[model samples]
Target: MKIAIISPGPFSVPPVKGSSVEHDIDEVTKMIDPEHQVTIYTRTCATYPKSAVEENRQFIRFPYNGPKPYLRRIISHIRKRKPDVIMVENRPIYVLTLKRHFPKIPVFVNMHSHVYGSPGMISKDKMKKVVRRASGFFTNSEFLRRHFMKTCKIPAHKIHAVHLGVDVSPYQVAKIHYSIRKIRKEIGLKPEDRVLFYAGRLMRAKGVHVLLKAFKEVCEQDPLARLVIVGGTGYGSNRLNPYVRELKQLAKPLGDKVKFVNFVPSAQMPLYYQVGDIVATPSVWKEAFCRVNLEAMASGKPVITTPRGGIGEVVTHQGSGFLIPPKDWKAELPALWKLLWSAPSIRTEMGKNALMRAKQFSWYATAQGYLEVFETALKKRKAASPPTKQDLRKTG
Candidate 1:
């Protein structure tokens, strides 16, 4: 059961900031059998030592001097410490390297999201080749599985749709230390104020701007409504990013009705969700799974999100929460205004529904699903190609 998770050369495992892919890798690795050896390959610019082991898992971080240097370092490490299976995060180009060098080793290319931005470095044809060669593909949502099948022409059997799960303990209703009264008082929210929370990167694609625009209209009509944004620039970068600047401009006219809190640590995120009456993830782009929705649902708050990609799979329309059409903030406005202005009993009922729905997803369940995929891929690889003299020598 030895596993090697190859992370993209941008972030570390158990990402200190916002990295859904790295966070999933960290969680799944922890859920795997402690008897099995699991190692993660990360990229870092820090001056710390190159390798470290913690929590029954090993991490080998390589310096990101340049593409060539990083690739050389990664190749060197993989050659020396080959694992029973290779599980790679997104960025198919890197997996192509493993396929080229260790063709027999079963490789699983897990797709977290396809809409992170441009894939400027890797050509389309080369990426398709990587998809075709992978022993199996893991997608976080059924929407993404279909996308891969359509775009890559990968066989349906090769793709597995396993939804991501949230760490629900911190968000449990009884386990939470911060009560609604304390959270509201700390945030300067009045007893009568209604809060709409958004906790994610301030990037435009995340639909922060859409939320701001809709909130402005909602606030104009309902002065008691407030929007609380809790996240800074993504990818652990502290610099004042352009998206942050743009979001500020969009929120300027709205004044203090819109509050922006810089990146809150993962441990304290539950407080923000507990304080708010509603969680709004107005993302314009098609999210693969929309972890924010699940986190909010776990925190016992209904979400008003778009029915893009796998988001519909998580949030039921008017059941646990309301699902709006993508990029249709105008449509979102009426629903948000109605919900924010609704009676306390109505909101509470929806929150109860959200909590019930959130209970169905768990990190342990997600880990088991991934292990099943790994076992199946290994079985398929063994049947397709028995060990040859070269593979046997390499194993020896």
Candidate 2:
């Protein structure tokens, strides 16, 4: 099948850093069956070319001056390509427009977050139209599927839940152990330090401030406890803001116990994962499906995160990792930190279980899930389509 995938338009396909939706698109496209011809429509970057082909996939880049221009460029190319199906990533409005232009073609939208589907972003009437017009809808988690059903009144049958995945090869135990010592030394982490890692946007919604408060308590109790905060205020952005300044103020009391590493590239994330004894993604917001949890599990480290949204689906409570409720994080985080720090056996066991669980969610599985949705949608479209002139002639 010839597949056309439309990116969210804000970020490049192989995202520079910090766009999980783009990262997911890039990974899934790479893992898709070689027999299928895949074409990706994404925003152009200075580092990338206008168009390029790799294996069975082709990438077409367009300048994203605004949403109108980007859509115009993609629509022009898509009309020429006439792919078997079209998959719009993280943009519900695009599905409505694309389906209007190419009514016969099955256009599907994949919702990666609640931001686009909310009533604030798109009206209830338009969302209803999207549900009625689009061939199918895909979400990163069951939580999000239910969310759309409630918000947009979409039918259960129209929405399908396809979980995101991680590339577990680089995070294998042997590879991590080999480079961990060097990485730790370079980061000035002492051998005795029990590092607690946080990698995501340094925003209050992500619960970074909450984590800092909890970590401050942990540090007072355990001299070896350390916290490493990764990522910037936004994707590909490390510039300081009010929230960042506030975070610094919060961390000041803890002093050198907290180290902030701003905006590491996605390619080098595996190395950063190795530097952590445990990974924490204390997001207070309902994350659709966080790749950080998967990456940490794949790295053979137990994650301490809230069970909000699809995180519960990814991290098993007390089995693979600890899932503290967002409200209880202030009280529970320090306690869990102490438990994991004091008991090496429990941490090791959970880490092993985490690695095992991580194996089930691979890029291959993610790609196959997407292909199944596309194929099913295409088949349904063909079945419902009107008979061609050739079919009438054959009957005559």
Candidate 3:
């Protein structure tokens, strides 16, 4: 099975911003390589240095300036490569390109998120036009899968749900333990400080503002807490601390209670998980799949996250850690305090449980799942009639 994965616009293969998307593409490509030839199609951004192949994986680069007609450029690459199955891992634009360029191939548009109101996905009408025409579609969560089907009217069978992957083995193999104070010392954190970590895009929908508010309360109530926000700000770096600056301003009321560092490379992510007493993800919007939560849990740290979005499935409430209501919506801070001031024994137990649950979401299992989808779609493509205009109208 020779498979070609077409990642959507402006994404560098190992992705500078969204590690999950890049990591997903990397893992799937590697997994299928043993049994199948896999080629990944990603962008050559201005930032992407000269490509020198290092790992078993290869990075194939192409020029892309902006969103306009970039999909044609991608399909042009795919048609030349001639993959058994072409997997496009983003939506809208690529879907349209598949319709125009490679209408014969089994093009699978795997969607990770959907838009609501506010100038969504081309026109909802035009998307349905493509969804009606494409061979198949996929989303990472049952939540998103249902939404895509309901909103787009694509059959449930045509839309596949592939949960995103996380590497659990590295954390398991490199697992370490330390007292809260000891962990603090190791990370240059203060011995007296209670560390709360938030890593991922610093955006309003990520609920960074909400996390800042909660952390401020956590400090006012506990007096020993410090918040460390990691990962690059999501919207353009030029965008005025934007939502992030506002969060910082709110935290200024509590001196040294907040710290913000934009962009932590993926390799050093485990350290952020290791250094925190409790990890925080307060995303107000649907996160589709919270890979950071999986990463944190893999690092054997208890997570504090809001149950809204697909993360409710990712982190079980009070099971892996605590899944509180939205930070702004919640009425009580005492529960947060109890967890913050918890005894060493309780905190250690929660961390262990978090890791236990994290093991359930392995990169191996995720890769295997993707392989199944690829094989299934490839088989369908092989057996089907040469895609005709009539085939798009044929109802299941």
Candidate 4:
């Protein structure tokens, strides 16, 4: 199969933190490289160093990612390549443009998340329209698959699930130099402090506010408890993100119990994970899929997340981690505090179990899943094509 994938932002391709969507494209493209030809159309302000570009795959950057202006360029490129399959990372603004631009090819829209929760750039109604048109579709989790079906009225038959994978090997329980004490002193840990970490976006949907509230309660229960919140500024988000200010005020009465890091590079993430006694992902709204949960589990740290969207599929409460009801952090507090006070031996056992669970989902397996979809698309496309003019005369 000859495949073309369209992405909206800079090409932060494989072995890097290229956002979740890019990770999906890179893994799938790598998976099918031996059997098929793949091309990824990315939007980058700067070009990739030639030494880093892949030999088998092609990456093309464009001027504008939006449709009204970029559609002609995309059409021209598609005409030149004439790919057998089109796998687009869909956006509502580009649906009609795609309908006219790549009219005949088999287009599969990989809907990683809906625009329903996004503050701007695209509306929910617009996303629904684009999702409804794509003949083939894929989602990050079963929870998200259900959301797509419910919101867009897309039939379940057209969609399939291909969960994202993380590099689990980098994180281990071997007690490396970046141990909890090593990270604690760097972050200014107190003598009796207990660290409960929350990593990822500080967005409303991420439920960080709820985690802070819960941390306050935990602090009241045990004075030594400290919570660290880590994430980056929103991508193209206009909302006032002085969360560090708000969160500090909220945690103020509780004393020195909260700290925030706006950005943490991928290389140093495992060390931070090594410092966490228990990881929390307290999202009020349903998560499309929580990659951080898997990352925590793989790093041999127990996770506590709500059972919404595809997160429940990974963070099995009490088995691998805890699941508290949505927006009910108080109820979730006791279980979390218990883990905080538990023996190091008990926590280590849970961490081992967590790592064992995370090993099941890997990039290697994720790649294979895409191959199944690509191969199926190729077979179906071949079967559906009508005979050529020369064959029509033979049939007559």
Which model scores highest in lDDT?
Answer: 2
Choose 1 or 4, whichever is better by TM-score: 1
Clashing pairs in 1: none
- TM-score for all models, in order of appearance: 0.89, 0.96, 0.86, 0.86
lDDT per residue as tens, model 1, 1-396:
778888876666667665778778887777877777888888774533568787768988887666567767877877888777888788667777778888878888888877421257567788777767888888889999898888777799988998888777778753356476786676778888888989987787788888888788787678888888888777555457777888889899988888887787665677678778789998888888989999999988889999888899999888888888755776567666675466777788888999899988877788788888888777876778878999989999
Candidate 2 weakest lDDT stretch, 10 residues:
171-180
Which runs in model 4 stand beyond 4 Å of their true positions?
10-18, 50-52, 65-67, 116-132, 173-183, 190-192, 235-244, 389-396
Best by TM-score: 2
What is the per-residue lDDT of model 2 for residues 1-396, given as tens digits with 9 covering 90 to 100?
Answer: 999999989999889865888999999889999999999999999989999999999999999998878998999999999999899998898877788789898888999999988888788789889989988888989999999889887889888998888878887744536776887776678998899999988888899988888888788788898899989988989989999999999999887889998888888888898889899988989999988999999999999999888999999999899998777877888889888867889999999999999988978888898899888887887788898999889998
- Candidate lDDT scores, in order, read 0.79, 0.89, 0.70, 0.72
lDDT of 2 at 80: 94
Better of 2 and 4 by TM-score: 2
Poorest lDDT segment (10 consecutive residues) of candidate 4: 44-53
RMSD of each: 3.7, 1.7, 5.2, 3.5
> lDDT at 23 for candidate 2?
93
In model 3, which runs have C-alpha deviations exceeding 4 angstroms?
A: 17-19, 45-58, 116-119, 172-188, 235-239, 327-330, 385-396
From the highest lDDT down, the ranking of the candidates is 2, 1, 4, 3
Give the distance in Å from residue 29's predicted Cα in candidate 4 to where it truly belongs: 3.2
Q: lDDT tens digits, residues 247-322, model 3? A: 7687788766676666766765665566677888888887788888988898888888887768877888777777
Alpha-carbon error at 102 in model 1, in Å? Answer: 1.2
**Cα displacement (Å) at residue 377, model 1:** 2.3
